[model samples]
Target chain A: MTWDWAISVLGILAGLCTTGSFVPQVVKAWRDGETRAISTRMYVIISVAFVSWLGYGLVIRSWPIVIFNVLNLGLSGVILFLKLRSAPPRRKEA
Target chain B: MTWDWAISVLGILAGLCTTGSFVPQVVKAWRDGETRAISTRMYVIISVAFVSWLGYGLVIRSWPIVIFNVLNLGLSGVILFLKLRSAPPRRKEA
Candidate 1:
């Protein structure tokens, strides 16, 4: 395969890894009903970043970029929303 | 600007956010000295993914991809290492 095609494929595969990394975080937090351990600020920043990715994907007309960011936006957005909705984690005993 | 250039810039911007997202996670986890709250499996997977990204970047000759994944690898790698080194979180009371 040509270099461009090869890298594109590799990029997609790498993106898939980064993209899917959030799955367990969301699934476990949602299932456990406690997301206070997660950092709201981090996720908020990430969500905005995903939006940026979305814009880039649209500009490039790249389906993988578009779809990846969309899913990430949803996953991170939900986590942020949950964090906002939930009470903070309690302090551990001294 | 042409579509390719525009998207490249946008992608760089987006990639920055995603790339940096691990910063806070790493810092907080390290400072707090408690990564049990963070999923070890998620990070192990992500670290492996970052390697894939590194391979992809190397193949593509893209500095952005290479640098991004390198930093990500270090960040995630540290978190994983810490998580492995630390004990699990204590059980919460009913």
Candidate 2:
């Protein structure tokens, strides 16, 4: 196999591992209502970050980056929404 | 500007944004003792996820991927340790 092919395979494998990691968090949240454990700002910021990466990937047409970011974009967005929905709205303070 | 250069710039910007996103979580955890909210499994799993990406990036020799993963690896490690340190240990279930 060519070097580029090997690298692509590695990227895909890495992407799968990282992507899979979020599944447990999602599951934990669903099963235990663990969304409270996550910070709303974290999820929101991460969603934006992944969206930027998704845009970059689309522009460069790198499937590895594109695929992972696309998947995570949806996942992070849902997580963010869930966090916001479940958490008490921040109180307005002087 | 050349297409490749533009893509690289985009990738870097995306990387920075994604990398920056975690700062809030770390700060939140430190300031609010918010580690109670985070699932230990999430950080542990995500750390492994990024380590895999780091390996892939190193193999592929992609500087953008490598740089982001490296920065994130240290950050994630610190966060994971903090989560473990601050949170109460899981009980021995019958």
Candidate 1 CAPRI classification by DockQ: medium
Q: Model 2, A73: alpha-carbon shift in Å?
A: 0.7
**Clash pairs (backbone) in predicted model 2:** A37-B37
RMSD of 1: 5.5
User: Taking the tens digit of each residue's C-alpha lDDT, what string does model 1 give over A9-88?
Assistant: 77888778877887887777777776644666678778989999898888768898899889989988877877787856
Q: What's the lDDT of the predicted structure labeled candidate 2?
A: 0.76
Per-candidate TM vs. native? 0.82, 0.86
lDDT of candidate 1 over B1-94, digit per residue (tens): 7767877778888889877887887777778876544666678778878999899878767899899889989988987887788865679999
Candidate 2 lDDT by residue in tens digits, B1-94: 8888887777777778778777878877777765655666777777877888888878867777788898888877877888888877679989
User: What value does the lDDT take at residue B43 in candidate 1?
Assistant: 84
- Backbone clash pairs for candidate 1 read none
What lDDT score goes with residue B22 in model 1?
75
DockQ of each: 0.52, 0.60
What is the C-alpha lDDT profile of model 2 across A1-94, one tens digit per residue?
A: 8988887777777777767767766766766665654767777778877888888888877887898898988877767766776787789998
Each candidate's fnat: 0.58, 0.58
TM-score of chain A of each: 0.82, 0.84
